[model samples]
Target: MSTSIATSHTATPHKGLPPGPKGTWIGGNLSQIGPRRVDFFLMLAQTYGPIASFRAGRWRLFLVSDPELIQQVLVTDARSYIKHFGARTFKPVLGNGLVTSEGDFWLTQRRLLQPAFLKTQVLSYAPVMAELTEAMLAKWVPGTSVDIAFEFSALTSAIALKTLFGLDDHGDRVRVDESLRLTFELLTHRLDSLFQVPLVFPTPANLRLKRAIADVNAVIDGFIAQKQAAPPGNDLLSTMIAAQREDGTQMTAQQLRDEAMTLYLAGHETTALTLTWSWYLLSQHPDVEQKLVAEWQRVLGGRAARASDLSALTYTAAVINEAMRLYPPVYVIGREATTDLELGGYRVKKGYTILMSQWVNHRDPKYFPEPERFLPERWLDGLASRLPKFAYYPFGGGQRLCIGVHFALMEAAIVLATVGQQFKFTLAPDAVIDIMPQITMPPKYGMPATLTRR
Candidate 1:
């Protein structure tokens, strides 16, 4: 779970820094942070100002809402920090994939994975997006409520798998869906305190996690070993397998397995969350929905959307950005300082944690007025131009920004555009959505929505 591979951290403290929430006897604000971590931080931002601190157990958690300090930590002095432990803890699940790992290895993996999703290359995958959306919509029954969140999770799962590994079997759809859903659910809870004990009795959660991981790993291992032996198409996975260093060293099978898991998880989860929230936002704002449909109708005219059409779907793109702003899939970006440094004239030492929550930053009135309202027009006319780059990083910032960002945006915009042209979704009557945070933000119990053919 160590972010920096168990290396000793280098963070210094400042003199008379801002006030923080005081700790109670045992847990401090750990329990208070609650299931709603994003809301918890936003409340702290309200109570403690832009820069505040709170105790999680004995750990001092600094809550940063200032863009300047975040820019310094993530970009200008990025090398002095690394991804936080929450991301690192998934290393067993993610391997040294782009989301996890540090130093040269992370760089190498990024390079290897980059080509598969180059801008030109990603555009070629648009047809797959269109096809997959249609395929999913074909199964929906009119007037029945479906969990659109679950629907998207499954949709993106299939899209990522097919686009990367070429799993196109109709019969395996249910199997694939179950494998990913179980893995997603297990990953969040399996690493908790109760399961951390060595040789402990298996709780139902533990048992479920063990079985789920075993199933997913077996499925992935089989596909990977098969691909390695036969060597198929030039998809993302194939490109990754073929990646070599200056010394001409390619990734080992184990590395390939790890990277595949990383891509699989990364490719689907965050993208699904983005699309899910987009659907929710669109349903709420009928005006935005009208404009979005107009754009789609003019662009596609009842035909399937291509990636090249992504630029023409500006509103669609803006809506995705706005949704990410309101409900960013990766709710936070954190780093552990390796060297003592002065940021915003405040001294912070090595090993000190600096966090910038999209939950807080995207809503700061200085950058976004009435940030809670789902308004995509705020992104038009280059309205977001004035803000610092790191001020809004749902996909993260810097060279470490998501490699699959183009893919996710293209997938979400294209699929939704194509499907929305054919069907309209309204929130299933009285469905209460609780945005749940785990490795990726998702609606708890899924966002049930009724679909109607338009």
Candidate 2:
């Protein structure tokens, strides 16, 4: 692997970091980040151009809004960067899972887990995704209001656990669901807070978060104990259990727990948010919704969608893509510079935080015309192929690109096709939709919609 090491000496010692909005001496631009960092990032890109520098407390951050620079950081020169310190918040929960690890260890874990996310494996999980969505739709009564976010959260959680660990028993699944929800809520709460105390503190929020983590860990431990005794199964957890290294050794119990938790978080949260935003966008744009429904009807002939239907559901896929472009689930990607580097003509010093915002890039007018509008048709013309690689990365890019890209895409398409086939969601009268920026972006007030039977 090609890696860039941070150089204490600069080729041009006089050159400095890129320009950004000035801030307080100590706080820097952190105070400006406020509750809506996504918006602030967008504004920074608009105000200071693609590569901008700002300080948040003692931390140095460089926002790479330009697609080429983004590509440099994520794809062409990925080895020069590693997981940033901010990811430490997840370390308490994720352990040394794929998202948190770096170097040889991360590469080993990636290789071992790769087989589980291959094309054939992801395609096999589609029926479960569709079935779970169908089950969810079955519970929705016409004209009744529901929080689509919460509903999709439950649906995707079930799909994630089943696909990852072969969870089938309804009782155990419910317990996992409850625990996962509490854990995510606590995590999100912690992420949004500006002044976070250490987890060791007996603060109420920390206490609750600790309890939620323990509950989640217990659920995963149960899954591990059961899978340990059984024959190797088709699920991701089982695949990890059966995975062998160059030395023909398997992952340890702690490693298994780490991966399971990582999958549990990375697999479900973004997908649930993707579906939630898709439904919300569809509700707001009737023409898009009509086109989506028409595609489902034309493709499925009033039956449920299948993995086989994914290819035929082009418009359905486009709608989901467009929804993600508007409100990407993981809005920002962060990496730390391992060595000194020049990115987009700016001299990036070693140890600087590199921030790339999909929220900003996906909405840039240069790459996406009518950037603010929900226009799925734009995607139908192969725009993704023509535009820059990093322009529309809802699933990210390069080696560290989301391991579950195929799985998430197929799941989104199947869920939309199945759920859209039988029901259409209209935003509830009192619904106040806004972005809640966390590890995964979601609607702050929840997506309140009244489900109508088709």
Candidate 3:
């Protein structure tokens, strides 16, 4: 659980920097950190040891792979940091939502939205999660080839729509889906680009991004309007709509849209990736899949999964935990230092950005033996409890830990149990599994698989 790097590779007192790969005078590590950034971070950690420093353009970024160092950035010194610039790129799409907001406003929003994601509240949505999974499974035909990633994405999106806004209309779901896809794709492009043009500029990409944001905003606005016209409901949006601050002020209209969009994106995308990667891993390891199926058969006996059945599905949870360890949905989380500080014996300037990569930490050979292999059995022996908290953080950590952690885990388990009871997937002959590290790490090439009844 305690991963120690070579003391020799640790930060040295040379220009107050940690040991890292040297780069060009102008671009620094930016040019070298091409498309597959997850791999780049992994290389940084492996090559330079746990705490590595590099520059991306003008950004003084440190890749902190040490679990103790990660803990300091995410928990102990969390208040000294804010979300890095990469997160801010999606503000046009996310608005001032929880994911991007900072300081007192972020705290207030977190407190207001906390009730809806509480364990008891999240459990109330388990039936809906199972129902939606069943609906998806109802359409699956044995011997048919499908993109498993797309299937799970659509399924989780539907669950998000229904659970967040109480709207199950297919048209609205498709509209929001398309708009968000376009919006995220555009924002990702901007995030990768070296020179970002202001949104005010009428560049073609900016114009397209603007339209995409407006399209999604239109869908969200309509949902809000409908929710306002009707009686209050149990959905998250309704909760947000009714929530008032200690000063008796309610969230403004824009605030509602931002928070709703944040919840919708966070609620679905990561869970979708979790399930997607889980199926992919299950496809590769039949022995593991068989063990998972046996557990599901013993627990549910061909019935749909319920919230109460979660604790009984030990192997199922292990499979998810292991899959996330290998391909974490939110691969890397970055925090910008708000003031000059010392980390791992190196002076972190006010604007320095610290990146803790789950992609790197989760695979630490010290924590997980045979880290590259998909071994769900490793977690069956209470490994999670033994590992350093930040070493296996798929849901993140600290005060800003994902509010929907319980909800996502429950949904993943239920959906996995509900679907695994009936069908198992086999990867297509020519399927090329690769990581596409955007806001989340989804398969670069879609997961092509044929379904078969278990």
- lDDT: which candidate is best? 3
The full ranking of all candidates by TM-score, starting with the best, is: 3, 2, 1
TM-score of each: 0.90, 0.93, 0.96
Report residue 323 deviation for candidate 2 (angstroms).
0.3
Off by over 4 Å in 3: 1-15
Which of the predicted structures, 2 or 3, would earn the higher lDDT when compared with the native? 3
CA lDDT of each candidate?
A: 0.76, 0.83, 0.88
Summarize candidate 3's per-residue lDDT along 1-454 as a digit string, tens digits. 2356433214653456988889888778888898899888889888888888898877889999888888888888899999999998888888899999999999999988888889998999999999989988899999999999889989998998888788875777678888887787788878877788998999999899899889999988998898888898888888888888899999999999999989988989999999999998888888998898889889999999999999999999999999899999999999999987877777888999999999899888998989999998899898888988888999899999999999999999999999999998989999999987778877888999999988
Q: Superposing all C-alpha atoms, what RMSD in Å does each candidate have to the true structure?
A: 4.7, 3.9, 2.3
- The most accurate candidate by TM-score is 3
Tell me the tens digit of each residue's lDDT in model 1 across 1-454: 0001111124333575555677677676776777778888888777777677776554455777776666667777889888875666566556666778899988877877788889888888888888888898889888888888878878888888788887663444456458766666666554323225332467776677667666767777876766667646878777776767879888787788888887887888888888888989888898999998899889889887887787899998899999999999988887877777665545666666777788788887777878789889988888767777867888887768888888888888888788789888889778988877777788886888888887
Worst 10 residues of 1 by lDDT: 1-10
lDDT of 2 by residue, 1-454 (tens): 0111232222454387777899998778877898789889888888887777888777899988877778878887799999886776677778899999998999999988888789998888887887777777778899998999988887887888788888764566567667766666677666555567888889998888888778778888887888878888888888888888899888988999999889887888888899999988888899988888888878898887888988888998889889999999999999999998877666778899999988988888877778899999998988878987887898889888899999889888888888888888888887889987767787888898888888
